[model samples]
Target: MSDVVTCLWGRAGWDRAAQGLLGAGRRLADELGGKLRTIVLGPADEALVTAAQAVADSVVIAEDETLAEYNPESYLAALTAACQKFAPRAVLLGNDAYGQELAPRLAHRLGGSAAGDAVELSVADGQLRVTRGVYGGKATAVIALMKSPGVIWVRARAMAPADAGAAGEVERVRLGIAADPRVKAIARHVEAKEGVRLEDAQLIVSGGRGLGGPEPFQKLQALATAMGAQMAASRAACDAGWVPASWQVGQTGKKVAPQLYLAIAISGASQHVMGIADSKVICAINRDPDAPIFKHCAFGLVEDYEKVVGPLAEKLSRHS
Candidate 1:
């Protein structure tokens, strides 16, 4: 057993963010000369176990039918128990909705500190340091945690996914789950989405106010379909009701780090640019020569989006 322990809390299906957390946990374990343990709540699933074993040194499963659906109170109670028993040096969670709520509460229970939306993590001289954006993603700040069992909420697409390695052992843990009368989850509704998920897409085609209206988004969607990419929108487009809120991408929306990001008619506001700062390449299309997106993009086309988007879509569709 290692003196230092790094624990990662994973969801059932193991989405990209979960994979990223596992990858980050593995690296942290290596850095601290510790062991990597993944904690999964819910019934046993082979796929979940397999995914967890790909990167973890051990998979700790808290099996229960009640865990099938997400209940923040129940999850918090289970996690609190696990952390107490495991006494990990660090705990990592995704910076998603659940994590945003759980991390701070868990840290409070553990008498430790919590940090969210961490883009970079490192340890030196027995202190864990995290780098993240501040001021609505306008700048960066590095935070150092002096306490043990540091709780970190990792940002999506910030860390590299862990490659397949030696399989890990699976351990089962039991925790008492009590229902909270304060909150009850009556129903769950999932919105239907087509094509690739925005966060998981390697290529993203985003539209902004320059598209004129929602009807023009169809052209962008066609381009996205042709390129096998996900379609996204700026806050302006979402606020204009041209697209669903789920399609928005910015500091106020989902953060993306696609390999290639296409910004059509977006003015590249600071809030919007902050989300795609990690994209490997950015291509901007706007009619205004002085559009702010041009400065931050690798490729720029100062042509009317109406004239160019249709042709571009056609070209890609033919090739595809």
Candidate 2:
């Protein structure tokens, strides 16, 4: 059985698959000793086919008028149909909102067990061994599967994309209408995709309750823009609603592995530190010299955040 993983690329159909998911998909593909397959659904989705060719070996299309808009049931129907026909060794999905909800249901229908939020996978003694992070990344529990085929949902942005320039290939799969059930999305509202998302940024600059209020966040955003960095907030600032929940950086928020992390006025709570432990370098700015963040930081500034943010922003502007 060849390895088969699906790329749920954004709906324009031609745009490149989300870079974050591509990494884990490629890793699993190589480990499984087979080429990866990608799937996208849309109307006139020629572009979706074109872009997926770069990462996956084959492009499967589920083109239906009703399927143009994403309804979980419709997608599950078409996807399950495809997998049953081919019967891949294993199926992989991202640990995203959609993936988390769909993978378990798909596994039940396929008559297999699914390991959620799997961060590690390897070929040990011929069987596919999966490692799932348990207790919030404190320990990794290994899972062995004896069954023929199963499903897995790996965490978001956990793996890096592999280079397979010449291996790209494309194919098409046509599907008939799938059943539509009780729940229906009557309307779809799309939020504007703005400023670097937490997943894609190379660097993150964060502020905490020390920033005073929502007014200072404008300056932080300007600094983030000038320095080509993402703006993040500690749980405190996020609870205050100075920034969106999506921008929160902590154990409760998105974990980031940026090249650099700048902490201004942050107290360095362990909850906050957990998310940023993967950063290449950390620099904390706080008035107190004994702040806990300094212990983990590579650099430290014992000064008021309001004072340093402006100067640092200026210096970054000049260098940029």
Candidate 3:
């Protein structure tokens, strides 16, 4: 039985489970009186390894050309080998795209079980107890996994990443080098996109169909850029061509848990609400009091957003 919790680290920034993984890492470090080893998977490895050294007790470096763009096969293989060699009691995975894909495969390889989107996890009755949200984020349920070694994917924004000031000097080691003849990163390219990516943004300012047309969506965009925030569009706004699909936020688009989510002229549909449910503050603006958005919004302003927006924007500018 292992008493350590190991984390899967990323190079191009950790996915959704960044916070919870760090939280789990710190907790396990304190509980076990041992260190949390953060293992990073990368094609270009050094950059992120340097970043993780600030928090982790030790860093495991896995490198491969096939892993340049996150090919699943090599990643799972390397992680499984590391887990077996280290024999950590628990493994924490980031619940983002890569984490969701890698954790299950690693568990399968290690002959253990895996759980996804876990919000709360604890050791109870000699078993791992996990909490996960379900039914459209309306309710959460507890689950117990009776496995010797626990494997889990903690969802994005579930727990904040640990804040350890200043990074330690990173130690570079080539432990598990992958040999995959399947894929190669010949070139890397970024498609031209808008100002901020919603998933990584600290603040998000969004608009919806209630804004009327494409003409008014600019106001939200301007406000977002001015405040150094990401501009998000509801599914309805994208469907109407008011904004691009990449900026759309909802169950179908993207799940963002920014610190602050401001819904402008938005009625707050369930599909839209579910995406940003992890936001610390939800301020929704809509003229319709019964828009259903009010039910979930922490701050609801019942006024024509056109009138409320200019004053709000003006007031915000004053502080900046």
Please name the candidate that would achieve the greatest TM-score relative to the true structure.
Answer: 1
lDDT of 3 by residue, 1-320 (tens): 54455555555564445555776666755565556777766643454565566667776666555444566677777777778877776788876677777778777777777887787777666667778877767888888876646688876465767776535444445555556767655787775866556787789999998899998877776677667788888998899988888888876777788888999877777788778788888888888888887877789889898887776767777788
Model 3 ranges with Cα > 4 A deviation: 3-10, 14-20, 32-34, 43-47, 163-189, 193-196, 318-320
> How far out, in Å, is residue 1 in model 2?
2.6
Those runs of model 2 whose alpha carbons end farther than 4 Å from true positions after fitting are: 12-17, 43-48, 146-148, 166-169, 249-257, 265-282, 286-304
lDDT of each model, Cα atoms only? 0.82, 0.73, 0.73
C-alpha lDDT of residue 104 in model 1? 93
Winner on TM-score (1 vs 3): 1
Deviation from native of the Cα of residue 235 in model 2, angstroms:
4.5
Q: What is the lDDT of residue 208 in candidate 1?
A: 98
Candidate 3 matches the true fold with a TM-score of 0.83
- lDDT (tens digit, per residue) of candidate 2 on 1-320: 85766647355333221444555566666877787777665554555455556777776666667677767888788768877886776777665566777888888888877777666666677677778755544566999766646687765565665564635665555678665976698887775687666755778888889998889988887888888888898999989988777778876677777888999889998788767776779999999999999987999999988887888788889989
For all predictions, the C-alpha RMSD in Å is 2.2, 3.5, 3.4
